[model samples]
Target: MPAPERIPSRGLTDTELLTLLAEGRLTVLGQVRGASNAVLHCTVAYEGEERTCVYKPVAGEQPLWDFPDGTLAQREVAAYEVSEATGWGLVPPTVLRDGPYGQGMCQLWIETPGGGTEPSLLALVESEEPGEGWKAVGFAEVGEGRTALLVHADDPRLRRLAVLDAVINNGDRKGGHLLPAPGGRLYGIDHGVTFNADDKLRTLLWGWAGEPLTSEAVEALGLLAAELAPGAALATRLAELITRAEVEALRGRVAGLRTAGRHPEPSGAWPAIPWPPV
Candidate 1:
């Protein structure tokens, strides 16, 4: 069945956006390249106002031996639910819905700073020199037998995102997933490959390893743990999306993070950073 013909206005608040996305008419604008799945840049309109959103359709998902098929879209929505329940707001508003193609995950789009008149809030660039104000995360082999310094903004938002990734057990936190919005706000996207039962966290934000977690970060972890308690809202919602064992694993991660009280150190069992860092 197609989505409903009428949707609420685009004047939706963050909370309201979720409801609209679940039932709104989705129009695909174009394809977002470089994604493993079929990711479409889409516009969801209702009552003459429109908003941009990224839609990841499940039917287009490539089979993975590690992750279950047709469940990535649900995981994306689950990530957003966790972020909101913990009061972190690190992820943009996301929801599982029936789109133009089929069932998929739709996330509210955020404008990249400096797209026009706005000054650039964040920029991802590579330079030969690893200058100050920039933190060298890893080395990338640029073509022509040259090594390039891959650096990221040394911003507090990036730090918070690292903590969020740890708690979620994100397996693929690529540099391209970090979007810097206005006012130093950082939004983490592409959460389709997260919350696995095993330790699959691969990311680029290893600069804070062994550092003590901030007091606020600790509190957020506590909140997430509480939200996953038996009969908790997030637990109930997650059960509908993922398996029971996965939810238990998520709880375990929260407990582990709380016990450590510091940023995670790479276990060395797997690659610390993902391939193609940026």
Candidate 2:
């Protein structure tokens, strides 16, 4: 079991990688194969610092008949506290502590530079018009009976990760959870099916579906609707990681995207894309 050594932490600082992923000394360094849970690939350490992360564990979660048992490691630390309340770090510092397979969700391991050959915010284009800086995300198949289009990179870091998967209702934004790090910095990771008080928004970033919400995503959803009101501090740390009806349905989806300034359109009741959509 030996392949874990990437350890960059981009020279540490989001409060020293969330205090070395919440008081380090973890150590697994293995198991992250195709992950449906139990991810591990550890490292952590403390005082005498160390890095690499990604823990997962709440006894290796896997229940999901509609997300309840073991709460998917507190919805992956409430999607890293709503991606650090949308100032847009795009989720990487996660924390929910106590590791070595006990309480779960650690995080902070974002390396990804040339190893992945770069240039891919996802693509496929045989050509049904995902031209100029691409966006499409529809036709896929790609086998004997063909079908191609399926685009993505219109950039602004994937439109601020489709406005943080529409304020964390993200159900499974695959495309291998979009991490592109180093300089062009993009992160996103497996938010354990996110803050679901329903309307589970599955995604491959829908390429700004309805369009219009970027005055820097309406000023980061108006400062994430004043830090999700009701006793802020990000609604008291997302009420210790999700559920008060999924943090009031994540503050009613940032007040329904600040009363629909746009960029939504796909509620034909879920499944708007995400099934090996890479």
Candidate 3:
């Protein structure tokens, strides 16, 4: 099936978009292919305003050994909460509400530049070391027994996303999850596997592993630490989306980052990078 036409939500304020997604009339346009769970491409309208969105219903979630069943939709919303707290807006506006299929996550759709020719944020180069404007993310097998170094851009937006992923314990951060919207804004999606109480962070943004946290990251972490304190507003909101233990783990991660003052290093207990990295 042909893809639905992209509709930009640039004019709506974050508050307005969230309200529209939560209360608007949702019309499913098509199903997004390649998602492990059902992801519907839909348009949400309210009070004569409309915008494109992606909806993932709880009933369509596949059971994961690590994650609790029927909770992926909530996790997606939790990830959005954490993203918004960071002030980076790395995640598009997302909300959880009743949909045609059931309760699900509805997120504002982002429109990328035409022709899939948006400048590359990730690449595989023959050189062992990455050139300027790029950060090496280790190596990958290309085909025919050849290997190439995998790298992502040295962009600050990606760097911020890395920090946010750390806070959420994101277990998947594949290249396809990075959405480069118009006006240079970058957003990350498909956070259903996130916010686990365990150390399951897997991503291609490990380029800055062990580096000193950027001043901006430190500042964001500081604010997050306060907001995640027991009974804080953000904490209260998150408790509704995630388990209490998971919420506590999130607090520990932010505190740990502030104390370490550096990006997290892989613990070696699990896979450091997700499969099919791009």
Candidate 4:
């Protein structure tokens, strides 16, 4: 069979990109290096429009003792749905579909506009005190075994993401997962280990720990709470992706966070952070 024609990446709108994700002819571009299962970067083509996306096939996922097998891809899509429903726009456009590698979650790759590369929020420092706009997280070893101070940005969007993570019970919120896009926008990825029935919100965004959530952030939580109304569209969509108990856990987290009105301190219930913090 002849191959599908390609389209301009910059030309497609958000809605159009989603349509292409669902119906586009996916062609594997390459494998993305990571610790977990196979992650493919591909070109999604449809109706003369094409775009780059990340595909995480269920068959490629490494089995986890805690989370059920073959449901990581669904969780990826669920995270995106939550982001959309809450109007957070923290997660990129993701959809669950059958790809070249079988059933998987395919998400449109977010390109830095104007070809500008944004740095990860975790910045490395060598023996220098963290200046303004940055807060030290911990220490790290650099080249020649030099010790370096690792820090994260004090941006509000990150705080917003921190709140979102609490709501989803994100099990793994790595520094590398936080992508800084053009125009100062931040996008998060690698959400296959989320929405567990148990509390597993491991993250390195402790800069805002124990701090009061901003009014805007609190309002967003309220919006998410309302979206989970029994028979609401968001609730129905999530039910199709995650377990009923997981959905209920999401509701519980939202209510708990809203009641607290402050960024939570580590409960010491589980590991407070993920390994390889960056």
Candidate 5:
């Protein structure tokens, strides 16, 4: 069944969500196993196929007052593309479509496998147990085939994500946002406050006081640097999504880090990043 031609801004409520599903309005096959804010995940039949999708049906103009930026709804799509462009398809694939709920968006649902829980990169490396390290990720539900984000300690993927987070100045890299897929594939989400030029390093992942930078790691940084040179297409594309100021500020930080050859360390006295990101 085709979606209604136009879904209102306020998006779908649970009742309508089910109604549409029953009538083959959009073929929602199963119940919502997990949800947060205005998002829900359910199994559905679409185009003669059984699939599950995460539905984000935002109410119109009722933007997340807490974060208060309407542009994020627009940016999430672009960010997915950016990660794909950067040779990191670890991110989720998305399908922006009308919802059975509010102004709906359908993203391909990625099932968290029963392969243990998401590892906490912070805990994996923090043998020092120095201070409050990135807390242990919840795996109870995950390993039991329930829904939850995952991450791990000692994972090279988290290291790469940390670098990418710093580069993007992602302000929302909470423990829960780092979803680890079935077989050790890690993915980051909730990038609403990203692309800021300022220092937005508010995450819980680091080891040995964030320690000295490794040579191989620096090589990856160098690789990214070389890829983002002036007139570089990737950098140019990023410039369009975020303000030129934000992009330039990001470039400066990357350059400085490359020059210094270091993993980022906390400098200011700001408290740790909040978990679950509202």
Candidate 6:
């Protein structure tokens, strides 16, 4: 697990993502709530319908974000690209970019047929199943919608996210980040804090701790473990964003669990789960 070079955002640039959208369609969509640095909700004008999006200023007063100014946005862009390329199904496609401030990431917004997130996912998690109640609770959208991603245990998709979260060492993956759109489609958002290699997998999605793994989940983990080997080739963005130790840990975690033949346990310690699950 060699450390990847410091190539922020894999190789995709912010403006470049913006240019990916049709030209001469710059328009302000909306305003997002929150004051962490420069978080805001924005919409980018696109073909046919106006795609919803998020806006985060690059010139922020935060350190260690790689891009203290505008790096997170760029990294997010790169991450989305990688996920789309690898068919990881973790993130949405980058529809367009407004120089990092806002991005038109056009994955199906996970809206119900005609409304915000559907609640079926939540209901399923609340059922009598494994890992049904160990999730952190809070809602915060990087976008403008007041709707939050409804995440619950029992959903194989949730487990898949855990595998990805573990591999990326996502320091934050509250329930809110897992939005359930109108359809069965689930979207994972706020990947800005992802791609680290430390044991920073802090999240509230483990409510149903120690539940048995689904057969499909086991297979997914098996595939992930295979991809996280020592000499594994990765997308440029992930190589630089994740650490060697993290990759090793990811490899070991995925491999060990699959080999041992069990569902993931709520291991390690954290500060009583984050205040908000977002």
Every model's TM-score: 0.87, 0.33, 0.95, 0.88, 0.63, 0.62
Angstrom error of the Cα, residue 149, model 5: value is: 21
Q: Which model is ahead, 2 or 5, in terms of TM-score?
A: 5
* lDDT per residue as tens, model 5, 42-122: 665633444456555555224544344334544454455455544555456543456566445455555565533354443
> For residues 208-254, what per-residue lDDT tens digits would candidate 1 score against the true structure?
78888888788888888888999998899999887888899999988
Off by over 4 Å in 1: 1-11, 114-132, 143-148
Candidate 2 — which pairs collide?
Answer: 25-45
Q: Look at candidate 6 and tell me the lDDT of residue 54.
A: 52
* Number of the top lDDT candidate: 3
Of 3 and 5, which scores higher on lDDT?
Answer: 3
- Displacement of residue 197 (Cα, Å) in model 5 is 2.3
Q: Which ten residues in a row have the lowest lDDT in candidate 6?
A: 1-10
Superposition TM-score, candidate 4 onto the true structure: 0.88
Q: lDDT of each prediction vs. the true structure?
A: 0.77, 0.78, 0.88, 0.82, 0.54, 0.49
Ten-residue segment with the worst summed lDDT in candidate 1? 1-10
What is candidate 5's local distance difference test score?
A: 0.54
Q: How accurate is candidate 4 locally (lDDT)?
A: 0.82
What TM-score number comes out for model 1? Answer: 0.87
**Clash number for every model?**
0, 1, 0, 0, 14, 18
Model 1, residue 243: distance off in Å is 1.3
After TM-score superposition, the amount by which residue 230's alpha carbon in candidate 4 deviates from its true location, in angstroms, is: 1.1
1-278: candidate 2 lDDT, tens digit per residue: 11112234547667887887888889997998877678988888888888888888888787888877337778877777776776777778888888766788888777787654245678788988999877887888889999998888888877888888878878788777787776567777887887778888879778778888878778878888898899989888878777688889888888988898888878988788878664
